[model samples]
Each structure stands twice: as structure tokens, then as C-alpha cells.
Target: MATPSLQDGIDKSGSPIELLWQPNAEPWLPEVVDREFTGWRQEQAAWHEGVALLNLSHHMFDMWIEGPDATRVLADHGVNNFEKFAIGQAKQYVPVTRDGNIVTDGILAREGENKYLLSGIPAAQHWVQYHAEKGGYDVAFETDPSSAFRPGGGDPKLFRYQIQGPLAAELVQRAFGGPLPETKFFHFTAVTLNGRPLRALRHGMAGQAGFEFIGDWEHAAYVHETFLKVGEPLGLVQVGARAYATPSVESGWIPSPVPGIYTDPELADYRAWLPLFGIEGKRPLNGSYFSADIEDYYVSPFELGYGKLIHFGHDFVGRDALLAAKGSETLRKKVTLVLDPFDVRRVIGEDQDPGFVLSYARHRVESGDGLVGVTMQAASIDPVGSVLALSLVDAEHATPGTEVTVVWGEHPGSGAASEADLGFPRIRATVQAAPFNEHARTLYRRDR
Candidate 1:
């Protein structure tokens, strides 16, 4: 097993992923995005043709919560209901402070009936202990180093590599020597690689068919080496953090760290553990990337396009608050808008303006004015030739073809700017409809 590094910094030496994401004094050049993308495409193709693996250590959080009342403990602090989460199924929710600030949202996987694995950051553990004491659940939780891939519980780190595209399964089948048809989405099963028991989950963060493998500290190097050996012929390259940026963006996943969005005096308690949630050292907690003229940057479930998933029939942490504000007047609606690519390119270059590129779709409104929904995560899915933005607006405007205006740019005086001398660059955009790209992802079933 490789010796884990010190806890203060990311595993710079142990994991190549750290090197890939760093722009300077790193293996790849600072201009990697513009120059190396072509080669990255070649590698992506090779890996698709064979097998590709990624050390997901940088992007994961390891927390182990133990107690007789662990399950009950999680139920109290979560903004959403937890009863619906089945064993082995991943449940997502936001942990809120007493003041209603979103601390950080994360996934809880049912590891055992009595115990749960809350993956995201130490924030989950903090909240678990907080409510466990309040609710008298008798649960004790802490960040477990053993939860990491190495022994002695050194640095609680693990790696995740996405095997994607249409050929993902075939490549896995080739390496593991079996049919890959049995795995179900969000379901994980264990397998052995180089004598190490690796856990593979059939969840695709890329929005394509893919799997994520988890293991203890010893398997990282072997896994990385093995993936390269097996994937070379098929076309695989170690995808850097910059290259992975578009995939994360295209996946429409919400980002935790941003200015004027989650950071605020309201979220002071939540901001303490931003590092575990991958948002630390970025900037102020209650600021925003968009300036004053772009509309409110906050979001509710309605604007995040998850209204269908929000059930008010049961009591939840936020049930009373959500119910008190019920009706079209209360709920914000979410929308998917198709943006023009020409506008997005202007935001990417060195000489270009430091600006926001329609991060996520959301609506603007306040209580009692009816639902002025907000948007969540938005992406520019190049495969579909459209800039996709997800927004939450009043339910009345949720329908397709509803025209909405999107504003992008950095506010001049906002905390996002490192120096006071820096000027903000903002832009205005028009958006329309959901499913901005028709090529939604789905699991492949040949028999069906």
C-alpha cells in the first residue's frame, strides 16, 4: 500500500489526478485545455475501445457514522425525507442549519440497515452528530480514515474513474472476464482486482453508461496501472481535471462553491466544512459569480427541476416551511434552457473576460410574489450542440416554449475577484424550454 500523504493538502504525490487538475508546475501545461484537448480526444477514444479507469481520490469524501441510532440521526437534519431510500440505493439531500442555510448536499448510501455511509464530506458527520444529540438518536459519527483506499486510516481518500460512452460495459466485461449485463443503475457489487476487493457502482455521473469503483488504500496504483494497460489499445488517456471540467458541466451537476450563492452570514455554520464538500479556499461563503443585475442567485427545488422528486405528502425537515409556502405562489418551477454556443466560447480564453457562463438554470422571485423560480446546474453539452441551462421559475412559466432571460458575468466588486482593481464582465442571454438537448441518458437493455 502507498503511504498516505499529510492531511492538510490534497494527495499531490499519490494521485495523478491532482497533478492533472493543477495548471502550473504540474505534469500538463497551463494551456492544457486549448492544446491538449485534441490528444485527450484520442485517448478517450482508445479507452472507449478497450478499458479506462480513473483514480477518483480527489473528488470523493469519506465519512463513517456509527451508532445504534445512525439511521434515525440522518433523518432529522436532512431537508428531504430519508424513509424512501432503499438499502444500497443512493439518497440525495441537503443538510441545513437551524437558520435554513444549505450547509452542503450529499449522497447517503445504505451500507447496512442500522449503519449508513454518508459520502460527501465531514459536514455530513457534523450534522449527524448535531441532530443525533437533539433528536436523542444515540448515534456517533466521524470521518473514518479506513474508509479511504489505504490502511491505518491514513488520509481518508479514495479514487473514482468513469468508464463511459457506449462501449463502457464491453470494456469492463473484457477486463473482469464476465458479462456486464447484471449490474443495475445506482447498484454496486464487489469484484476482485489484483487480489483487492473493488466495489463497482453502476452510476454514471457523466450522464452516459458508466461505473465507479471504490477500494481500500492498497489498490490505487495497481488499478491505475491496470486500467492503462487494458485501455491502451481501445483508446484511453488519463483525463485531466480541466478536460473533465466540461463533463462535469455537461452532466448538469450542481457546484457547491460559488460567490453570492451558498456563501452568506446565513451559512456561517455550513461554511466551516466547505473543504470536505470540495468548495474550500475558493472565496467568501455568501457571494455569487453573477452580479446584482443578473437576478437572484439562490435556488429552491422547484427551479432545480426536481419538483417531481419533491413529495409534500410526508413530514420532512423542510416540510413545514415548504408547506407553509405551498401553491404556485409558493413553489418555484425549474426549466431547461438551450443557450447559444457562440456566446460561451468568449468566456474561456486567457485574454477573455473572467465571467460566469450560465452555471445553472434558476428563476428569480421572493415569498408572496408567487413563484419566481430559480435554476440549478446548467451545462454546455457539446455533443448536442446546445448550451443547456436548468432553471427554477414560477410553476406557470415551467412549461416548454416559455421565454426566459438569462444573465451571465462577474460582478465588479464581488468577492470572486481577487483584486479590487479587477472589473466585472456581465452579459445578457435569452433562454427557452426544458430538455434543451433531446439526448437524455438511459441504461441500455438489449432484450427490451
Candidate 2:
């Protein structure tokens, strides 16, 4: 077990940046699963024109909070308004530091009056669990870390499956042998399939109509095998771990933003609680953006699209600081950078496989005379035929059709000589809506 603590890790590295900038940082892909099913590119295209069945059972961790104070415990730390958070509805839960910088975000669903399931990256769960324990809240917390860290290294507590793409609804309806509930976005309902009940939430990746089903882990194998049998003929392709990471590029959600837990005196106790090998201490960084002060890498929720989700009607942990940052002219706006196809051919080369080029890649986004933004999660979608990178740039540079240049490559002195062999490549890109795909931006949640 990688023992010690995050504080010790940081102390040994001399600084947080030094600890994070490891040589050839590993891609943040799910463990215990094939990187591809049919092929990542084909799997990606399936979600665009046909249907994609993503096996999410192995990746995300889960936390169960139940008790009289469960709701209040979450309400105090979360930015999303909880007054009307209904029993079966889910929201994009965001928590920020005392200074209002984002800690992390996750999908929080209210399962009962005093029962909730908070699941996603471990950073957010750890933050909430730490507070729940220390604050004397009347809540019982249970964690089911992803299979990656589960003690037995067996099945997880729950199984998550997502059906998405153009024919998603039709395929699922066919499987049900009837009509699906006219569920709104982020809303879930108990649906029966093969005499089994599961929670089906209306959501998607890469901005398409989809449903994500969650249920006991015991049902995973049967449900998956049954779905694959029934869905294959309907153009349903199974998406694997490698291709699953690209959805954020098209869906516009930034995965694994550096948690705002380090360097905050308020979070000193948290660092002490975190293990050195845990996600926070071990999550490495790549890309062109490098700063000695790790705080420079931190971002606010406003920089991302979550600004619209923030509610001020009730007080929360970072309420005062967040209140002050509201509508600050300096905050960067999230945008998608469509890397030039020609430049991609020249720099990445014709033989470069698009489906596998992933990292904590941060490319510098420059607007003519000055640096305006940083690009993250650059990906080459099979359907889009061009590499699209989600970036946060100055508001003026965020307008669609604005031209910018991305200095593509990893940070200097951080890795293998092959990375250097790729050479310093600059590619031209255009600024567009955070979701580069039109379907995601216009029609995804339009019905809601």
C-alpha cells in the first residue's frame, strides 16, 4: 500500500508542481477493462451515427450518504441549490475551495429523503466524506471505491451502463419491448428489463440522446450480455475504456481538473488524510502549461460552463468568495478549439492513431500577439475528422470563428525523448462553443 500522506509526498518533492510533473505520465484510462472493443475509432463513430453501449461499471467510484443530516451535510458543501433537489433527480454537484476555486465536480443523485449517492472521481468523494466525518453530521458514509482500489479487487458495488447515439432510444425501447417513460434530462426512473429493475437516467456523452442505467453489481454480467445480444443487430457497438475518455471533448465536461485541495490552509487536514498514492497525490500532469506555484493551475467553476448551475439563494462553504467573483471580467470562458486537420497531419503525422492520443495534455492557446487560453483533452473524433480540444480562453477570444494557435506538445523536460522527437508543433484552431458538436449544444437537452 502506498502509505504516508499527500503532505509527505509534497514535502519530499519540494513542491506540488514537481510531484505532478512526472516523466511520461500515464493516460487517465480505466483499469481492468480492454482499452478498445471493436476499435476506439469505430466505437466513437458508432455513438455518432448508430448506437454506443458504454461499460461504465468499472471506472467511477461511489459514496452512499444516509441519515438525518445527509442532505444538509451535502447542501452545506455543494454549490448546486438543494432546496428543491427532488428524490429522483440528479444534478452536476460542484464544490469549491474557501477562495472559490473549484475543488471538483460529480454527479449527485438524491435517492431518498435522507439517502443519496454521490459518485465520480475520488477527489470529490474524499472531500465530502472528510467533512461528513469531521463535522459530526448525523450521516453514515460508505465508500465503494472503483474496482481499481477496491480491497478484494473483484466486482464493484454497482454497475453503470450507458446507451447513447442516434438510435439509442429505439434500441432501448426495443429491449424493453414497449415505451420508455418520457423522462426529462437528469431525471431517472425505475425501469424493468428481463424482470430486473434498474435506475435509468436520461443523459449522454458527446452530446446525444442517451440513457444511463445503474443497479446492483450482481446484475452487471447478465444485463451486459443480454444488452449486447439484443443490441448488436441494431448497430450497437460497445465502447471501451480508451474511447470512453473522449466524450468530454464533444460533451464539454472537463474531467479530472486539478483539485483545489493543495496549498489551502483550510485543507491541511485533508492533505493529512489523503494517501500519497491516492488519486490526488498521484494524478500526474502533462502538456505545455507549467507553473512552479501549483495554485496557478487552479480554475474556478465560472471558467467552465458550470457558472450557469451556481445558485446564490442559499449560503454554502465558498459563498462569500464566490459571490465576489460573480461576473468578474477576468474569468476565462470555456470554448472548443478545432485543430486544423492539415496541421494535425503535419505534426502528429499521417500514421498517428487518433483514438489513443490522450494525456493530461495542455497546449498553449495563443491569439495573434498574446496568449489567451490553454487547451485541454485534445482528441481526434472519428466522425468529426478533426482533433477538437476543449479550452478556456478570454471571453473576447471565445467567440466562434475567432482564430487561435495551439502550441501542441508536452511540457519541456518532463518526459521521454520521443516526446521531444515529436518536436514543437503549432497548430491553428478556431474557437467555437464549448461543445464542438452541434447536436450536443442545440438538441441534447432541448426537450427539457
Candidate 3:
């Protein structure tokens, strides 16, 4: 069977939110290069011990926006400030609905005066493309979807590789045969590797010192092999998708959120313009936090811990809503919830039972009688010795020691089981700091 493209599966009979949670639908899985290379345990340990090379070329979609009005178009549509966004600088690109809810976010890299590269989150790319086409912006866009999901398993426009850890800098230095360039966080610089020029972005997903190397797709093999040859003596381990996902849990970055464009009647035109088989239609929402009203699923930048990225210096889509949310007493803060060891053990133990499945789906979080928040990403990191989840909770329950309950197990309505039997398992959880790993917070971005 041929693989489905982003526009192949459209169910316009219902809202996008409703379609995502449709009963008996297939569970959503991220497109990855390889599920596992060595093993998740050893790959997870590589980031802390020596170094890990992660192949990011297959999972993310890359979009290039170039022209005179690219910056203006982005500023008008997104919530981020581009005043100081220099040629080589990059930032967490965030776009929101008119009501100030998050549409989608990803990494935005300014390649030149009128050239920008936006990678990740296809929804965000579509949103940008929609606005640029109709908003009368003098911008042209070229989108390159992930290789795994793209037709015919073709090569991507660029091959992205991340080398991260305590020794990542040393490896880069050795690869270049000299000192590494002075690149600040979220910044990129040009470098020569094997006589081929490439751009190195000073960024790390695992909360460690690292550089993301990006160049023409043709150089992918040479660049990858060169790193392996130079990094063999330094104990470099190639990471797989299994371990690549664990870092986000420790770093407190929420990977997925329901796009906010569903419920708003004002966005009906945009919805109609979108193809049927895109991320909105295909991505399934599983977990314990099932809601009839789609608005309940909407999240603001403040709730996602992106308050620092919002600046009122420029007029943008969600500026007013964000301004009001900033000063409001009712603020939802993002925090890490540490699952009780015993509860975790119970969930794991249940896996042995017949007809039972263990899911890492986001669950509903409760404080007392009220549903305070919802957990986003959950994972078990062996190094941390605890199963951690990223959650957005009310300010009252955002403290480190505040106790809460995470409703684990898949709900029957979520299509994991028949409707007659709903298996709702409540697990004890304690609220902790956002970044569960202290090293990720303190040393990830430090200059060595």
C-alpha cells in the first residue's frame, strides 16, 4: 500500500478536534528515522556520559520563506518579536489564534536578510503558508516534508544531525581540526568540515552542550561518517527515536499540543483551505484528558512556559490576549510531575496481564475536586530513576511539593478498549520544577 500524504485523509464532516479523538481511530506515532539503533537504555546514557549523534532529518518538515515581506508577514501572524532576529540567529517560532491560543510552534532560523527556515510542526508551516498567500506578502515558500512520510522515501533538502553531550564540543573541535566557532545559544555559524561548508546551530535538545549540523543532503553521509570516525575514540553512541524522546521529558519541553484552530468559527475559512490528510486530521489524541468541548484543549503561551518569548513591542495576532493573560491572577504554569514509584510499578506490572496495554499517552491531572491541569508528555528516564510528566497546572498547584493525581490508563472512549469497559487508573504524582533534570537546566546551555 502507498503511504498517505498530509492531505490524503480528510474527514470534514466533523471538527478537527472531534476527528482527532474519533473512536477506534489508529493511535498516532511520530515519524522517525529508526525506532532503535542499539537500545534505549544505552542510547539514553550516551548524552550524559560521552556523546550521542541524533538523526533528525526524517521526522521534521522544513519550510523556506523568502522575499521582501517575509519578516513582516511573520511578525503579523506570529507572537514572537523579530526586531533583534539577526541573519544567523534562531528562535522558538510560535503562532497563535486570534483569541491568543497557540496554533503551533517550531524552530525558526533566519538564513539571510529575506530568507528564513522554519522546521518542525507541519501545522505551523501550513498556517504560515496560508497567511503568506492571501495576506498579499511578497514571499515565496518551498516546503520539504519528512523523508519517512514524504513520497518514495526521497532524500531531504537538508540532512540534520545533532551531536550533544559533555564531549560534543571537543568532537566538533576535532572534526574541524581547530577551535569551535563562538556561537551563542540559538545561533548559527558557518564552518568547514572535510572541506565542505556547513552551518552549525548552537542548540541542544537533550539539555546538553551540542551543535546541530545542517548542510546539503548530498553531504549527509560524509558528514555522518566523519563524526563517527572522529568520535569513535570518544565513546560516541548513535541515538535512536526511543531515546531521542526521553530528553524532552527531562528538559520539560512539551512536544505536542492540539492546534488551537479547531473550535473558533473565525478560523473556518482556514480549516476549509486545509487538506484532509494533514496533521490535523491524522494525529490522534489519546490519553485520559478527553473533553467534549474543543476549547478546553486550547493552550496559551503562558501555560506552555513561553512567557519570556512574548514581547509587546510589536503588534501581532495574540498580543492583546497575551497581555491580558500576563497580568491576570489566574495563570496556568508549566511544571514537572514526578510519578510515585509504587504507582509506576503498578502500571508496569499490569503490562503482564492478558489483554492489557501500557500507553504513554498524556493523562488528566487533578488537584482536589477540580481538574487543575493536564499532563502533556510522559516518559521513564532511567538516569532520573523516576517517571516524569510535563504538565500545566493552576498557580496554586504549581509548587514543587504539591501533590496531585494523574489519571493513567486509556479511557474506553479513547478507542483503546470497548465502550462498556473504561479502565481509569489514577496514579499519585508530585509537582516538581519544570525541568526534572537539574543538569539540563543548569549546564545545558553553559559555555565551556
For TM-score, the strongest prediction is 2
Error of 2 at 346 (Å): 1.1
Looking at model 1, which ten-residue stretch has the lowest summed lDDT?
19-28
CA-RMSD of model 3: 3.7
Local accuracy of candidate 1 as per-residue lDDT tens digits, 1-448? 5323222222332322221122111111223123233344443343333344444565455566677777666666666556676666666656544433344566677777777777754444555655565567776665553233234544444555567655667667666776554666676677887577887877654445667777775667787677667766666556544435444444444554122223345444433333432333321222112232211444444434444445555545555654454454645554555554555555333344323232432323222323344445554444445446655556666666655544443233332432232332322234454434233323332211
> Could you give candidate 2's per-residue lDDT for residues 1-448 as a string of tens digits?
4579998889898888778876456787777878888998899988888999998888888998899998888888888889888999999899888888888899999999999999998788888888988999999988898888888788888899999998998889888897688898899899988888899999877887799998998888888987888797897899889888888998898987888888988788889898898888888877766556788678899998888788888878888988999999999999988888888887786545433566557667887756788876787776778888998898888899999998776665434432233455688998889777777888878765
- Which portions of model 2 miss their true places by more than 4 Å? 350-355, 413-423
Q: Is candidate 1 or candidate 3 better by lDDT?
A: 3
lDDT of each: 0.48, 0.83, 0.79
* Candidates 2 and 3, the one with greater TM-score: 2
Per-residue lDDT tens digits for candidate 3, residues 287-344, read 7777656677788888887887887899988788888778566768889898887777
Q: Residue 132 CA error for candidate 1 (Å)?
A: 2.8
Q: Which stretches of candidate 1 lie over 4 Å from their true place?
A: 1-52, 79-84, 96-102, 121-125, 133-136, 144-157, 257-297, 308-315, 345-380, 385-387, 393-405, 414-448
